[model samples]
Target: MQKTPKKDKEVINVIIQEYQKNDLPWYIGYSGGKDSSSMLKLVFNALKRIEYFHKPITVLYCDTGVENPIVTTYVYETFEKLKKECKQLNIPLLFTILKPKLEDRFFVKVIGRGYPTPTNIFRWCTDKLRINPVKELIDKDVKAVILLGVRSSESEQRDRTISKHKTDNEYYLKQSGSSSNIIFSPIINHALEDVWLTLRYNELPKSIDFNQIRMIYKDAESECPVYRESKGSSCGNSRFGCWTCTVVRKDKSMGNMIENGYSELKELFEFRNWIAEFRDNIKYRCSYRRNGAKGLGPITLEGRKIILDKLLKTEQLSGLNLIPQEEINRIYELWEIDEINVNYQEKRLTTTCIKHG
Candidate 1:
């Protein structure tokens, strides 16, 4: 561990002071990524320092269901460890895992509803899969201040957005629509190097093993599946997200993992690339948009069925429950509806031909 900087200490102190001053419930958005993990460590250390800290701190994690298998395991294990630690320390820390509704699941959308895999321009996955579930939880507490690990140094666009909405004292105010909720980006000013330094030098809770993150990523910078409402940009080159994400043109992160001896992920990487390739092929798409316009629409019924069959085969090979039973049931229901509609159209055409003859 390296030496802790004075500025880092001051940032932690400010977080403590802010927590002490407010009776408003605090919700920390934890994504099991480097930034969120660092934020959580700082918050835990701060709580330990406060002599009579009894305020409840809620940690929210959004699970997209399609996340890398290794990441899913890490998240579950870390949360369980944190809960045990909190119990021993008598800290009021609650960790909750948020998940998308059954109907909104990745397989359900792609196979049941025939929605195409998300792309850079038509990326519809984020809002339904990542944002809404977490937002529903946050909305429950009207006075909640969301703690984020977003650093301005991450991107130029992010920096400009942060500077635009920040308060005089540096607290970032949530934009117009979400005016009820405030954002506390404690590490906004911290550089990328500062972030890693703080994570290394600080005494983190036993529940968190920062080294695990380093081992998994192997020099790749990663972020949890936090939904950014701003149309800033996609996780193009970033190594952390749903394995099926096609917004980046290439999943460099997963490719790197496979090259780094995670051979188990090779099948998933292949499936992901296959889906991306299929998505670009006009043969797999419908003739019209859902709104009746002549544009790219959901995958055709035949396309959906073929993809579903392939995905199930992949699931068997990987020995992972990629699609749940509920989603399978829903897909059958959708297929039945499509079948009935097609039958009705055929019968109508037959009757019309007989009358004309």
Candidate 2:
């Protein structure tokens, strides 16, 4: 018998191979981004071929909770349409929405409790907002295999030494020696052109429309924030997230959307800008440092001195909803830690995970 050639494996075919596993649950890390969409298409096609196994494949959408309404609506609609159609066709596809804890949202932490915005030197949200929640979805009982959309072409950071990756010629898994969950990227071989060509050619069921997504991706100018590398030119669309991300200096995406007349996003945009300004004001933080006395650990990031009184002032001035007392109390508790010598960076995650509207 001749062995099947690895290069001959189509994206959909590679994904279909997973269906042979009656034991492990399949997890797709769908961020609703373009590459992820292409991966999603392959997954959809593959699952359709498995007529015998009625087991539902989990399509997990890690909602930042602050995603642009446009993307948010598209993601939900696509999932709903697929869920209904698959159920009707007896295809057994289940869509689940996963999100970072509410307190982990940027607005909740930064605007509510004055946690500083995320930066390259420190990105506290990845685990809580992107990676961790997805891991929880995999659960511990099974040999979980996750399907990630990441391709080597996306960024230099992603294009590390090939040996560092776990690819058997055609696909790469996120596990690439990092994450604990077993993950795979089937479209790792396909280029941007192939993905677009495939999407353009595939006559998707009427329920699974990508019209809105097409338009948004057309005008999108930034990369996805979750895995986006700092100091690189923006790729993909919408700054890797909602137009409201304050982590970047001046959210070009949100401003562009507003220029494009997504005026409905006005509230969200204003909220983001306010958060950026609050982060810029280092004086609102503790000059002495998070520790009772600051000597030196990591240098204090700018705007580490903002206190609660000013946070209230920012609430009044910026019209942002005030932070809940629970989160403020949490931040205060964190401040007591002598090890918190890193300034605003140290609190980014802790505060993001506690600040509630």
- Report the C-alpha lDDT of model 1 over 123-242, residue by residue, as the tens digit: 888878887798788888866788888887887767777766777768564643576777887787788777777777776577777678778766567574464534443455466788
Misplaced by over 4 Å in model 2 are 1-9, 111-113, 161-163, 174-180, 221-238, 291-357
Clashes of each: 0, 15
**Top candidate by lDDT:** 1
lDDT of each: 0.76, 0.57
Q: Which candidate number would show the highest TM-score if scored against the true structure? A: 1
Give the range of the ten consecutive residues with the poorest summed lDDT in model 2. Answer: 348-357
Candidate 2 accuracy as TM-score: 0.73
Name the lDDT value of residue 350 in candidate 2.
27
Compose the digit string of candidate 2's lDDT tens values, residues 1-357.
232223323666767765675557777767666677767776666766676774567878877655676678888888888777777767766788887766675445553444566665545555556655666657563566667666667545556633355556446443533344455677766666666555555544345445655666765532463332222412222364744455566667666777777766666667667656665553345444333453212213223334345555655664544455665665555444423433333454322111111
Taking all chains together, each candidate's TM-score versus the true structure is 0.91, 0.73
